[model samples]
Target: MAYLGVDIGTSSSKGVLVDASGTVIATAVRAHTVSRPRPGHVEMDPEVWWREFRDITRELLSGHLGGPDAKGGAGPASGASGGSSPTGVGVGRPGPVAAVGISGMGPCVALADGASRPLRPAVLYGVDTRAVAQIARLDAELGRPAVLDRCGSVLSTQAVGPKVAWVAEHEPEVFAAARRLFMPSSFLVHRLTGAYVLDHHAASQSVPFYDTGAEDWYRPWVDAVWPHMELPELRWPGDRAGTVTAKAAAATGLAPGTPVLTGTVDAWAEAVSVGATRPGDLMLMYGTTMFLIATVTRQLRVPELWSTVGAYSGTRSLAGGMATSGAVTEWLRGLFGAADRAVLLAEAEQSGVGARGLAMLPYFAGERTPIADPDARGVIAGLTLEHTRGDLYRAALEATAHGVRHNVEAMRRAGAAIERVVAVGGGTRGGLWTRIVSDVTGLPQDIPTVTVGAAYGAARLAAAHLEGEAATAAWNPVRDRCVPDPAAGAAYDGLHRLYRELYPATRDTVHALARLRREAAGTEDAASGGAPS
Candidate 1:
């Protein structure tokens, strides 16, 4: 018995601790970052996600091998004799944790009040393109084909209803002391089970306030987009969302009531940590933005992908994302200072393939799914002084492999039968950005064996909801494969047709330099008396 998992990502926060035969045992991370306050604003401060989930659950219950005793008591229970170790890892004795999962990087909003707190900093997700005029005034007063026929997705900047109507039309006193709404795994499951709930795959990416064929919450598009908030209870990212609250067990040493689970979003827990949840599978991931998901069986609506529901519960997905992959090679290894990432992945693998003539467009942070352009910028078409920083980090890894071959050709033009891809996060570790996204999506990936993503798929959805077991393909498998080369297919099919014609050949000069950088960040937030956030 062990479990526990965590996520929250978009720069970092992880956690793990598997066991009960599915291995892993301990892991932790925290990192942090994300608060581009203005230019297409991105944020973070749900109290830095419960202070990095209580500093990664007190460094994975205080590691050094022996487990869970420092303060997280309760040991030994479910099928008693722990297991694993012939290199699968978990060497026994971390007994009884039995649940607590979570995930994040989401269709985020995180309003809160009525004591849940946070009312300002949290409008992230879909790379926060500051709600493009509340996604065109909620697609012109909720219509765009009745919101892609009842929220299979359409209002874009990836929905949460135009960032809660850009905070009820620009922070009406934090939307009049907002009532509640959270993401980042239901704001850490409403701070460890004070439970305000939310999980049906992050409420089906909170589009026209969720309805994906009536799976729930559409109340006339939440009474025309958040009529004074209050709406969480959804639950299904492996159910059981309650337990663990003696003030979150003294700020996270587990025990007080244990059980937690309702988690989703971290690319559907990295597509349930790579079992890629069936029906034609897909799950790309490759983090700090470049997700894919797929797993369909129905509901394949495609205003260029994102059809939600399916973190288990009959299943259905289609998703796509790419507001930047490996964040444009960590912004060309922080503009070539290169102190890490194996020295810019060994100088972008000797700057080969097309990076020589370059053609990037990872859209820095202003594009998602098929071309849900959020003032889409980041172009970089061919450059000079004879290119280097290894051809601009191999043209930002072949412009995130031509934005994953234009989102796998918009998930095969919405029909979505994407056989089987896999690939998981931390940019699928080296191997030249998964062999340039398999020679620019000629397809063929796989690579699993515990990518430790979405905190090991939220500890395999808390070991399949407290040990009923399907521990994600027996705790992760398919160790390697990347295939597709065929002589680099005519140079990634002519650089994916100029990365699909470099976004309408530079969308009106990056939307007029994103409206003069949002009017110089709203005149430096009105000379610092702050406002445009």
Candidate 2:
């Protein structure tokens, strides 16, 4: 039998189908973009998620994922003979779809009416800094220390509580009708099985809304900020939410009663994809934003890091994220005429250490960790007329590497035991970025055999739901390792110092410029939140 996994990402939605032997049957992607309605506001129509999911499911169903014809066709990869699983779900044969797993970029604010109708476009994660005012207000009202002590994370742009409050304060109409909240995975779960549930990991990011110690919604705090809204029921990322409803089955070609797992944020799911769940294990996700998740036994609340429940039950995580990483390189690529990425990677490698004496700050979309400054802006320093596009690209990559190191240092300071580092995501594909990160941070990274990312992890979760977790543990193994170069690292040591200094030096100037730009654009308002301390 086959399992299907789908992930809704910032830029696209991807679906993957795999068989019992952990072989990929087929994959599909639907590219899309988020809407920037106003400065500091990032959103997407929630309908797009379901639409792309439906389209991707149709495409994957028509691919290598096959069953039997009259018994319901099989894809070309269906080699296993007919059989049944312990759940009697028809694992090896009859059921074309053993289980379905869903994940997506989160913790987001997707509010819906009582009937599951979206009230407005979904407010995205940290990149959407529109909730700054709400963050500050809530922190002052609720006491920042109490929040950190109970929530395991400070209220920042990443927290879901503030965004919900932002709605209640700014868009009262939307709040008046808001009854259900969701991230992409839970949103899909609601669509597929009519279940109002969210993974504990995602809920924890709701910050102050969920109490880490209690492992449940902190009812008093949640009610204080977001009164009268029905939250999704909590479950582990891999726990079974429900089965496919007949209505959903007809819409997506999934058989009626196909099991569905409660999925999680893309980064955690991506961590599962590469088997980075043990204590001291770090999963570095390189994508539009650079995310770092460190699996830990202790739940420490560091002001600079996000502490949350792990994707699996009885597990905990300390995480950090950069506002942008590959995004900076992609931005540079566009300015340089969108050069072929492979060719650019080659050129960047030739640019060598220090990017020809250039240093940069990867704050194109503000920042999330170590320095949680929404007012922080990108800075390119020590540039010259002679600098080439490749040099600029190299500086961008080095800048992100510095950010990773900064976060790693904070994680270490917080007493997180980070022993193993595994790299995953599209950014890991080019090799140059991963090597640069390794060289700059002095951390050797294990490259897994399968790096299809969160969608693959979602598939892995689906497989684990059927065959048990251990089977999926060995499903993806390290194929290569990116070891740090002492010599190159020594050179980056200086550049990283310069990188760190450049931010503070430029902060005041950038903050003023940012406000001026907003004023000029006529979008600056009281609700347009300011920088966080």
Tens-digit lDDT string for candidate 2 (190-256) = 9999999999999999987999888999889879977787877899999999999998876777888
What's the true lDDT of residue 230 in model 1? 79
Per-model TM values vs. the true structure: 0.37, 0.94
Count of backbone clashes, every candidate in sequence: 0, 7
Winner by lDDT: 2
Q: Which pairs clash inside model 2?
A: 66-74, 66-75, 67-73, 67-74, 67-75, 68-72, 68-73
